[model samples]
Target chain A: MARVIVDVMLKPEILDPQGQAIARALPRLGFSGVSGVRQGKRFELELDGPADEAALSDVRKMAETLLANTVIEDFSIRVEE
Target chain B: MARVIVDVMLKPEILDPQGQAIARALPRLGFSGVSGVRQGKRFELELDGPADEAALSDVRKMAETLLANTVIEDFSIRVEE
Candidate 1:
């Protein structure tokens, strides 16, 4: 089996309210000297076989249809042995 | 300068409600055969110098203070040249 990692993040042009809220709360949370906070999502998938083109295509479709909101976010997938 | 990547995830024992919700919505979103959806956070930081002990300490403090909710999450930091 292979391990697949997917990262989903809001596009730079999109306003990430979640990230903004977290950034605003940082100082109050006792953290100092921190500036940007871009929130994103990570997914780990245990694939049934070798990491191949077909698996990649399925994963990409998964990201587009469910894992990410393509209208506001972008995603990248990484595969590991 | 160095690039630092931080990955934050819900501790295995902790229930990830957001992940669960996303997993539940996947089928409706047209993704089949997706069973798990463990969500996490990623932060990319461009440090002011070569990644050194001091910089790592600062980043750790940031993770503990703001980047992650210690009660439910664990984090790992990776430094890239």
Candidate 2:
């Protein structure tokens, strides 16, 4: 089976409440050096079949349509054995 | 400024309801090639100082204590310009 890793990140202009909350929590937790934090999503997909060219294309299509919100987020895909 | 990326993933034995929900929704959305999906969190941290060795060590400490749960999750850190 071939494994695909998809990273979905919000656009630069978007405000991430989750990240902001984490940033705020860090200082209280004694980690005062961190200036900012942005949170995103990562998806690891194990495909049923081969990791061929066609499979890569199919995975990209899936990422574009379902895994990420194209208007507000950007996604990147990588293949791992 | 320095950027650090932290990858947080649940343990293999842990049940990921979010990933399961996404997998189930994929077929309904007409993207049926995905066999299994595991979801995780990605954190991008912006530090106030340079990306030096000291900064790297500090960030790793932050990840170990606050960014990941060692009992049920694992985290990896990376430095980027």
Candidate 3:
């Protein structure tokens, strides 16, 4: 089975409180030099067939319709060998 | 500023209810051919310096201590150019 990866991230203009919290806690834990952080979602989909153009197109539709809330997030899809 | 990506995924044996839920919904929505789905988290870190060895080391510590729960999850780190 082929694997498709979909990364769904918040829009650049959106505020990510979870990411900010991590950023704030880094220095306290002695891990510094991180200026910012943005949290997102990643999905690994195992397809029943090869990762051809048709499969990619299907994945794109799935990502747009369910995997991401397009009003606030953007998603990118790629096939992993 | 350099960007580092940390991908945190649940262990293969761990239960992923959220991903399963999505997988169940896909076929009903007319998007088929997906055999399995696994959901995870993606974090983008904006570093204050170049993505040198030291910065990567620091990110590894960050991932182990804060970004991932080692018991049931695993994380991978990469530098995004």
CA lDDT, candidate 3, residue B16: 100
- Tell me the lDDT of candidate 2: 0.87
Which number leads on lDDT? 3
Candidate 2 to truth, TM:
0.88
Q: What is the lDDT of residue A60 in candidate 3?
A: 97
User: Candidate 2's residue-wise lDDT over B40-78, tens digit each?
Assistant: 999999988887888888888877888889899988888
User: Distance from true position, residue A35, model 1, in Å?
Assistant: 4.3
Each prediction's whole-model lDDT (CA): 0.79, 0.87, 0.97
Give the per-residue lDDT of model 3 (tens digit) for A1-81. 899999999999999999999999998998889999999999999999999999999999999999999999999999998
DockQ (0 to 1) for model 3: 0.97
The positional error of residue B39 in candidate 1, measured at the CA in angstroms, is 1.2
What DockQ values do the models have?
Answer: 0.44, 0.73, 0.97
> TM-scores of the models, in the given order?
0.79, 0.88, 0.98
Steric overlap count per candidate: 0, 0, 0
Better of 2 and 3 by lDDT: 3
Best by DockQ: 3
